[model samples]
Target: MKLNKVTLAVGILLATAGGAAQAQAQPVQNIVLVHGAFVGGAGWRPVYDQLTHDGYNVTLVQEPLTSFSQDVAATRRVIEQQNGPVILVGHSYGGAIISEAGNDSKVTGLVYIAAHALDNGETEASNGKKYPNSAHPFIKSGDGYLTIAPEYYHSDFAADLPAAQADFEAHAQMPTNAAVFTANIPHPAWKSKPSWYMVAKADKIISPDLERMYARRARSHMVEIAGASHSVYQSHPDDVAKLIEQAAQNAQP
Candidate 1:
């Protein structure tokens, strides 16, 4: 009877190990989308719709853009709410938030769309100076907030988008606190987790060369969209969604 008891215990231990391995091998299905500055979560509607239609569980985080820590906290809250391992995707300034928040244990991978992938001791502002884009002249500061000039918004941000749509985006643009750009990243998740990047070749807000550098540093799977704008996620939803789907398909548990 003692030998039988020992055998049963050994079997139980093996079964538990197998279960843990199975969980680790499972493909990631949960997705959390973070939007960049000068815009709100509404901009992710196109990508969200496509992903949902493809049978993926996707959630969008609405950042207040009040401060860097706040944005990271908001993203972490959404990631924690996921039922399983997640693929975190961020656009533009949203990239910086994910680089910080993607350190979550549940995050399986990260996706950056025309976004910043900052390194240690680097802030978005400091990184931008490394490869300046054409939109700087259009940035106007008031009090402590920043926004693009309405007239140049169409040209600088969404040149590939329809004029009317671009105009509407400019009018409804979200104002981000200028101080948010200066916050340094304590830890960038790309250092540990796998990453994927999409570059908008025509992006006037963040230089495409800068995007390439970020991808190279992270060893990310990189794709370039020709003539795409800073609003590539919005203007070319299908392409952005395709790359995200690729990340989801390839992300490890």
Candidate 2:
């Protein structure tokens, strides 16, 4: 009887291991979208709608833009909601949040769209020196928050977008803490997890060269969209969605 009991226990262990393997074979379905500074959650509407339509379990984290820690916490909260593996998608500064938050156990992969994919000790403050762009003159700062100067918002930040929508986007900008750019990442998920990147070749806010450099360093599967501006997520939602789905498909258990 003791031998029989031992045999039963061994069978259960085998079953549990098989179940874990099955879970790993499953493709990622949960997607958490993080929006960048200046643009609110509304900025992700196009990509959000398309991803949901495709039957992915999608969550959009509305980061307070208050500070770096708060943004990471907000993203983690959303990631915690999923029962299975997740693909975290970030836009612009949202990339920084995911680089920190994507370290979660449930996150299977990451997607950065025209974002700052920094490594250890590398902040945008330092990257600015590495890949300087005259883009700063278009930004205005006040009381710890930063936003695009209204006058140059359209031409400088969203050149590919319609002038009217770009104007409204500028008006609806949500200010982010200026210091967030200098915040050091404790652990960048891209270093361990698989990453995919989309570069807006015409991006004026973050230099296109910087995007390429980051993507190359992260070893991200990189795609360059010709003529895409800094607002590529809004201007070219389909391409962004495609790359995100690719990450999900390629993610290992």
Model 2: residue 215 alpha-carbon error in angstroms:
0.8
Question: Model 1: what TM-score?
Answer: 0.89
Output the lDDT of residue 198, model 2: 97
Which whole-number lDDT from 0 to 100 does residue 179 have in model 2? 82
- How well is each residue in 53-141 modelled by candidate 1, as lDDT tens digits? 99999999999998999999999999989998899999999999999999999998999999999988887788778888888564646
lDDT assessment of candidate 2? 0.90
Q: Count the backbone clashes (under 3 Å) in each candidate.
A: 0, 0
Error of 1 at 60 (Å): 0.5
Compared with the true structure, the alpha-carbon lDDT of candidate 1 equals: 0.91
RMSD of 1: 3.9
Which digits, one per residue and each the tens of the lDDT, describe model 2 over residues 1-253? 9999999999999999999988777768899999998888787889888888988888899999999999999999999999989999999999999999999999989999999998888998789788886564635465778888877889878899999999998898898888888989878999999999999999988899999999999999999999999999999999999999899888976
Instruction: Please list the C-alpha lDDT of all candidates, in the order they appear.
Output: 0.91, 0.90
